[model samples]
Target: MMLTTNEDSQLALECERRIINAWPALSTLVLGDWVLRFANGYSGRANSATPLAYGAELDDAMLDMLEELYRADGLPPTIRLTPLVAEATRAAVLARGYRVKDASFGMIAPLAGLPVSEEAELQIEARPELEWIAGVAARQSGVKTHAGNLAAIVEKVRLPAAFASWLVEGEPVAFGMAVAERGMAEIGLICVDPAHRGKGLGRRIVAGLMGWAGAMDCHSAYLQVEQSNAIAISLYRSLGYRQLYAYETRILD
Candidate 1:
């Protein structure tokens, strides 16, 4: 079914909120309708600023204050240009010499008709265990250095969450996670072993998480993927997830 313009806008807004809630920051400061987040420099989504409302604008004074706050926290001045941000606000950040990076798509699919694989080997825990974190760190290099920070972030999640993994010969080969709130499931942390490529393990892993999401009464599920990742994009598209919005960060180092 096609979404009306207003329905699309509201869905994007809900996705933005669920994304922020699922992967929380250690601390957050609100300036107007923007949220300035910090998580000890773990990930851009956790440490940069985000707008909470559509068409939100930022003045020079507000930008300066946000920059100062980030610097005080030992982080670079960073702002995420999500769909909620105004074009003028984005232009202001670019004018201030904030370099763009990590362009990505926020995709979502309704859970009512989404298929979930009935793979018996997939394992899921309501709370992530140490092995799941270690498995993710082993597969994704970006998280290796931030393992402790990742643990800290996940521990702070108060919503209904699922940590999933697939083991081969008693060793983890794939991992994924899902957090459900307000009838929306924010699915992420999907990783599969390089040796297991082309086996559809990634899809199975996502299905495992979605299976859990459906059980939680989530109406829809969402995930973010870098635009450059064509393979991952194809995988998600094949599973009925469509781009709701795209976002990128502007950083001042």
Candidate 2:
């Protein structure tokens, strides 16, 4: 039994790693002065401080690289960072005069131990209702017209090998997306409609997504959340996500 548990844990960690590598576009690579440049898009190979190698020494090298990239592409000026993990790196950022504007938490849950309540009347759909899913997410996040665009993007990216789920009543109410790449499932853009905030719909959506991942033989799942969002942190904790790490940076405009 103990051996099985250890294997499961290892598998979960591996799955998480794969998910991060799979979705390079949504992934954060480093920090700059004005933009949180993502590894997604036309950005070539990612070269940022690894979780283990990041420290105060990284400040100069990272800043230099960020500046080079910033000038070369004429990208917007902003600091780049992630809410995933970079506690040590983030501390260095704060020491360098970067104030925390927003915060999110990293949360995870083992698929085997998920606590989904059947009483919630939650239903998991295979393909998300792109139109409805995007609208709900945009309204909840205050990103106007983002839903339509996001739906198109998701349709193009989500493959059978990857995992995606929508929490619905008669129509989609919440959505969660994940991809299995390196050996883990990376979860992103989890959203619940404002009208259904307290109804445990978000948890259901996550649970359903995890289930899909598990079905695909994924071992673990991971996500990034802002540090200031305490309510979300609480929800993830309730679902058994412990703090593995923290990441932060400033965005200069």
Candidate 3:
């Protein structure tokens, strides 16, 4: 049996930290209060700012600092908030015209209940194959991951990770990644080809990642899935994943 030494929130936060740490940020300014991250206009998850150690003051000046940093990177200023954020900080961002984007649920589960499909065909790689990278990038709409950025992002993950691709007719149709750190495993980047949906491929890919994590002696697994993704939420719920918290990225347009 796997022991969960940390509380749900703590485990979720740790998983989130490790996942963000895997991103290949072009520039990052980590002050004592918050972290401002940028990746040359890559995905917002890499470029947007995030608040940390919640007790710090979040005033207009800090907002100015964020704007300056993002403007320098040639991107709009955005702040990503989580349940860990202070209520006043969230209100401050909302009071401004910051619209929420990609509000998602942070879900976690023990590896024991994770289900793997025998019919699903998934190929696992330490480094993302060229086809796998291209397949994933194609599925992304806004803030897409170009080939170079995709390569950099995958290569930046120093922890034990597996890039899994769902193959159909010897071509990748879906792609995702699993990274294990500090006894916790994080599964993310789960994307499916629009041409091929409702095939249970997502479940299989997640199962493959969870199995891999379990084999690595990881006690627990976690992932951030969009709240609006009903199919994904249902699938994860069926596989015994529970919501730990929800986070949203607010963009200054």
Best by TM-score: 1
**lDDT score, residue 69, model 1?**
95
- Scanning candidate 3 in windows of ten residues, the lowest lDDT window is 1-10
What's the CA error at residue 33 for candidate 2, in Å?
18
| Angstrom error at residue 154, model 1 | 0.7
TM-score of each: 0.94, 0.63, 0.88
Assess each prediction's global lDDT (C-alpha) against the native. 0.86, 0.50, 0.77
Error of 3 at 173 (Å): 1.9
lDDT of 1: 0.86
Model 3 C-alpha lDDT per residue in residues 38-101, reported as the tens digit of each score: 7767777788876555343468878777888788778988887875566787788889888986
User: Higher-lDDT candidate among 2 and 3?
Assistant: 3
Clashes of 3: 0
Question: Looking at candidate 3, what is the lDDT of residue 187?
Answer: 87
